[model samples]
Structure formats: structure tokens, C-alpha cells
Target: MLNRLSIRSIFLPTLVGVALLASVGCQEVPVTGRNAINLVDDQDISKKAAEEFASIKKMQRASRNPAQIRIVEQIGRRLSKTVFWDVPHADWEFAVFHAPGVMNAFAMPGGKVGVFSGLIDFCENEDQLASVIAHEIAHVAARHTHEKYSQGWMLKPLGAATSIGIGTTIGGTGIYVPSVGSTAGGGVTAITQSAFDRGKELEADHIGLIYMAKAGYDPRQSLRLLQRMEEDIASKGGPTANGWLANHPSFPQRQIRINELMDEAMSHYEKGEVSRTHTVIE
Candidate 1:
């Protein structure tokens, strides 16, 4: 049913990609047991992320509140130390911006993280702030963005690449890969990519819960934060949340899935608390 050239185009890249993935892409997400797609190296992504993060920090009005800023850095440090780096390295910084017009936070590769003052307003306590920050860090930890860039041609399955140039899977929706360089037929690609993006957001939520729990923050607070975010988004009635909803699953769906992961996350919290309380002083 297949000839040599056809097989070469199909299986060769897949094999090479998989091999690269084994050495580079097989970064398992902490606590999620998901093996990430390796389209880029951590150092490479972190370098780029650091550049972008610096640019963003310059553009925004950084918060002057010493209290808020200190809190942000403290929480970030607590979580960052627990990161499971196959090649352990520390390059973490956390900042709080005083932009009331914005209500969000994000973490970049290289351990750079930022939170907006407006977002902090919504967070009722240190735990709630931990909820949001851990979620953003989870995105970095999972390498979601790099995996997205890597999904197109490299990940295309050999069997599917025979009929179509390359294909990718997103949220159980398998995209029909277009012929190489054919942007004209990318509508399905966009939609499928979007679905995968939403899936990544949900995955971050799950993993973030574990990170915060392990860091001695209760994961249930994240659920409360999400619940409030949902209400706020509904009230605002638009994309005022800064494209947060655009690539994310519906608020209700996120809430439901977070509810599912609650028990496991709480277990981590209980364990973490016990471990913390019993720290021996020599």
C-alpha cells in the first residue's frame, strides 16, 4: 500500500522527531504524569521568555506596594523551589505590577513570573494569590507554549502524514493536516489548535493545584479563585479579561474539572503540611 519516497516523508521525520523528543521533548509535567511534546529546548525557550518578560515589565507600571511585591516574590520562591527540573537550575524572579486596568498574571520560561495589582485585588488571601501564581507557573512547568509551536509538522503521525502533509491532535479532535506550506487550508488547523490550547489551560489548572498544594498552599483556594473569576467574567460580559476566556475552556467546565482534582491535590497538601511541621532542627 506504500512506496519508499512516501514512507521516507512519513516515517523519517516522525522517527527523528520522536528521538529528539525522547532526549528533549519527554519532559513529564510534574504531578500530571503527562509527557510533554518536545518542539524546543528549555534553555532555548527560557532565553526567549526572559527577553519577552523584560520587555513586558518595562511596558507595565510595576506595583510600588512593598507589601504586595514582597508577598508575590515569597510565594513564587516557595513554589519555584519545588520544581522538578531534570537539569536543575534556578532563574526565578517574581514581580507585581500596579496596573489596575489589568487583572491577570503570567509565568514565562526561565522562572520569570508577574502578577497584576488588579488580579491581586481579586485574591482575598495569600492562598488565593498562590492559586493564580501556581497556575501560571504550571504553564511554564508544562511547557505548553513550546509544545504548541512544535505540534504542526514535527508531531504529525506517519500514517496520517501519508494522506495529508502533517496533522495534530487537540482535545480528542484530530486535525487533517494540510499539504506542506498550504496556508489556504488552515481553518481546521486553527480551530483544532485552539481546542488544544484550551486543553492546555485545563491541564495547567490541574498541575498548578498540585504545585501549590505541595508548596503548602491549599489547592481549594484555587477553586475559589476560579469561581470568582467566572463570576467576574460573566459580569464584565466581554473579553475584558484580556483573552483569558478566548483560548480557555468555559468557566463552568474548568470549575467542574478542578473539582475532580480536588481530592488528590488536598492529599498533597496534607502530606506537605506534615512534612513541613516535622522539619528537624539540627
Candidate 2:
């Protein structure tokens, strides 16, 4: 009983409706307000991060310097108190790895932070170190990595309805792609990763300054740390010699913004009501 014209009318409208729903089903990122296209859930990312973390512990030497570990832990705790008091589930732990050649610091979801010994060489003192930890913390608080995963979920389909259900699995273990470093596979991922990564870095800079100020250190120390890091990298020839430069904003650009925010951060530091005991290390 179906004529060609009648069938065409039904098929065309159904196709358009599906297209519209497909477009609306993508997840939106927190803080940055961008839409993400991902297939994996947060539990997936968290599981992977935990597995990778365990693997790292098996392969690498954690720092033996208890004093240094305590210092870093203190900074992390103070920052958490001010910036992430709402994240009750945050199992905040700071560890110093013994890799002096690998200048790296990164935070996995759920507040697992690692700082390498090589990075300490770049920090002039606690404020500088706090800047690094604060930035990593921002990544976790803002859920930037999870946003990246959500972006991937939208573009790929296990099946339309199945994929839609997975979008709710938004946070999980950190998974890094060995070759391209966690975000090497998709069109949306590449475009948004750069923009989101850069935005998160800038947000960290701003929010980290607030943490530095609240913690009773000169937020200007953030700029100083980046300057020192740039010089250190230049002396070493290039970033390949050190892992600290692995994923970060360029020295000049980050330094410029930090400088711009210095005075405002200093005012907050001066006005902070708490009788803080944080020491400004040389």
C-alpha cells in the first residue's frame, strides 16, 4: 500500500529527527562549557588511571625524602582546603618519585598527584612548588580529562542508544595513550584537547594564584617558577631532555599572564584572614 512519494516523506522526516537527537546527545564540559564527544565513562578513566598508577609504582622508585614529601603534602592539603572542600571523596595524596631526570608532575582523577624529584630543582621554594601542584589540582577540580573522554564518546557509536547511556559515566581512571599521550585518536579530541588544555592551564594559573595567596605565599612566585623552568629547559637544550616540559604552556606566554595576575593575587594574600604558617622557601 506504499507509494514511492509516501515512503520518501516518512523516511526523510525520520532521518532528520534522528540527526537532531544525535546532535543533542553529546555531553557538555564543566567550567569551560564546551561540548564533549566521548564513548568511555569516568569509571573507565579512573580504573585505567589506578592501573597505570600501580604500574608506575612497580616500575619506578618513589622518593625516599620524607621531609620533602611532607612539605609537598602540606601544600596539597592547604590547596585542597581552600579550592576543593566540596569534593569529599577526594583521596588527596602527594608522592615524590625518585626520578631526577624526569621533571614531571601530573594529577590523576580522584586527587592522586605525583611530583618528580627533577621538578624540585626548578622550584625556588614552597610557593613555586605550590604553583605546580595547584595547576595539577585545577585539572582535577575542573575535570578536564573527563571532559576529553566525553568528547570522544559522542563521535563514536557502539550503538546509538548504548552510547547515549554511557555518557553518564563521565569520570574515571586516567588513561594515557602511549603514542599520542591520551588524546591521539579523534578529530574532536585533537581540536578540543588543545583548546581545553590551554584553557585549563590558564584557569589553573588564575585559581592557583588564589590558592597560593590563601596559603600565605606570594603568588608572583608562580611566574618566577615558570621563568626558572624556562631557563632550566633552555640550558638543557630542549624539553626532550626533561619530562617537565612534556605538556605545558610555553614559558613566555604563561609567564606573561602570571605577571598580569600578580598584583591582584598579592592583594588577596595581604587580606587573607587566617594566621597562616606557610614558609616561603628561598
Q: lDDT for each of the candidates?
A: 0.65, 0.58
Clashing residue pair totals per candidate (backbone < 3 A): 2, 23
lDDT of 2 by residue, 1-282 (tens): 999987866565455444644764454443344554433455655665666556555555778887667778888778777666533456677777765444456666677777766566556687778877777676666666665554443344423433443223322211111122322222111221222455557766666677678767668777777777667656757655423233556667777877877787788889876556555543
Lowest summed lDDT window (length 10), candidate 1: 171-180
lDDT of 1 by residue, 76-159 (tens): 777887675622553888977775534556666677786766667667788888877887777777766567646653657544
Score residue 60 of candidate 1 by CA lDDT.
59
Runs with alpha carbons beyond 4 Å of true place in candidate 2: 1-44, 159-196, 238-247, 275-282
